[model samples]
Target: MDADMYAEAIEYELLTQAIYKDILAREGVNTVNVQHNVSIVGRSGVEHQVDVYWEFKQAGITHRVLIECKNYASNLTLEKARNFFAVVHDIGNCVGIIVTKTGYQSGAAAFCKHYGLALKLLRKPTERDWEGRIREIHIKMTPRVPVSNETHPIVCCLCLRPASEDQEVRLKNSSEQNPNLVHASPSMRFLGKDGQPITEELRLWIPRQLNVLEREDGGPYKKSLELTDHYISANLGNGIELVQVIGVLIEYYVETLPSNEVVLNATETVSAILKDFESGEWEHVHSAK
Candidate 1:
């Protein structure tokens, strides 16, 4: 429950609302509002700010879901649950939920049972959740030569080589050049439609939550050590492979653990679609599977 953990909790709460937006729509809840820092007037005429608030109307009835995010090192205690229950009761017409990083204590669970409150353990998402989005697509070679087989292993759109192999070489070469560089490498270039080489400065940083390629101590070439330690600690247990390039971390793959809520971190204001194929469609690379 340090600063970083608090920030992560806030982000997770927002993410939860987004992930359920579509489902709420399907349930005929058209006026769903999911937001943070919501102020509500309780029955005692006092206002309180909630971490997350989800509300929708159905059949002239208002339904509200209030979520409290707790990123504590230890289990949530019964006292906290009682305070939350009080807020929910005062608010009225609301389902109360406590999302904790670790879990709830036995006493907290008992309190929740008695009060009909829901508890959810939260963690970062894993690779297993990205399966359905995985698609098999053919890769193209240099000069945009499409591979005939659709099920072929996807190639790096830049080097016209297996993406994994290309990434390995890039990482190896960077580490060799400056062992501290870990995943940071020079930007890749590809041939544009005009037959000229186009430098791909747009790159995605994977394992979204990790501070890889950077040292916790703010020294030189320190990313690998931190990332290695995280892997050993089971922080990055998702079997996710990430590539670092000389650009930006554009795409994000995120999941809230225990809840198994998955989200792609791309906004309508900022998104990139690869459409180099003849059909002019985005190709799905099944490498993540």
Candidate 2:
């Protein structure tokens, strides 16, 4: 076969294997082994090439299934179906299935139906297949920002003095470039009472402290508010310990962002759509083989 034909054949065989494997899994047949591009010896001592093969044992009886894949541009004909039936007959005691990219001729469909052979059409989904289906999703996200205009002095209970201008007490390992901004993360660590290292997640203390501060100030107002009840301490470097947070100057505002749209196209993600010729049942499948 040429390069294009070889590539298409490989893709078609793999697609068939993936679809059947998924179907068997959904049916709770976990013991089955599904494989692609296998060769099975027939009773006549002739080895037949099987595009996709699967077998399982049930009640001490081993059952096999053989699949033939065709990636031709044109529809399958009656002659092709008959040729495949010969292969299935030579390799007896196995179910036969034929999958093609395009639909089959009326005569070929009738021939497969008469011989108990399964005929399936597997191909990329077209625009018509997406009728009444979800094609896209829209998500709206609004961000609330806390803007701090000024931060007053933090008092140290041990020394009974305010922290120096050079001292900085913020979220540890914060990625924000601005030292005045403090971001919240569960992974952030801080020093608690007696200079013991602890996470901000301990007893949900950090969030509770912020909630108390917000409640006492009645939202971010242009005034110096002192937190007297909460005495959560943090050790700034250079032997400076902040035991009391006072005169917090912050403002909260909401910023509305544009809606994010995501398009869901089956043709983009799904490799093929399998349709049973007899029952007219169909499904979209992603290739993993």
Q: lDDT for each of the candidates?
A: 0.51, 0.63
Cα deviation at 171, candidate 1, in Å, is 60
RMSD list, candidates in order:
23.3, 9.8
What digit string (tens of lDDT, one per residue) describes model 2 on residues 38-154? 999988999999999988777888778999899988989999999999999998888999999778999999999999999888887667756676656555543332232334222
- Model 1, 196-231: lDDT tens digits are 444443232222323432323221221111221111
Please give each candidate's TM-score.
Answer: 0.42, 0.60
Count of clashing pairs, candidate 2? 0
What's the distance in Å from true for residue 275, model 2?
1.6
Best by TM-score: 2
Instruction: Give the clashing pairs for model 2.
Output: none
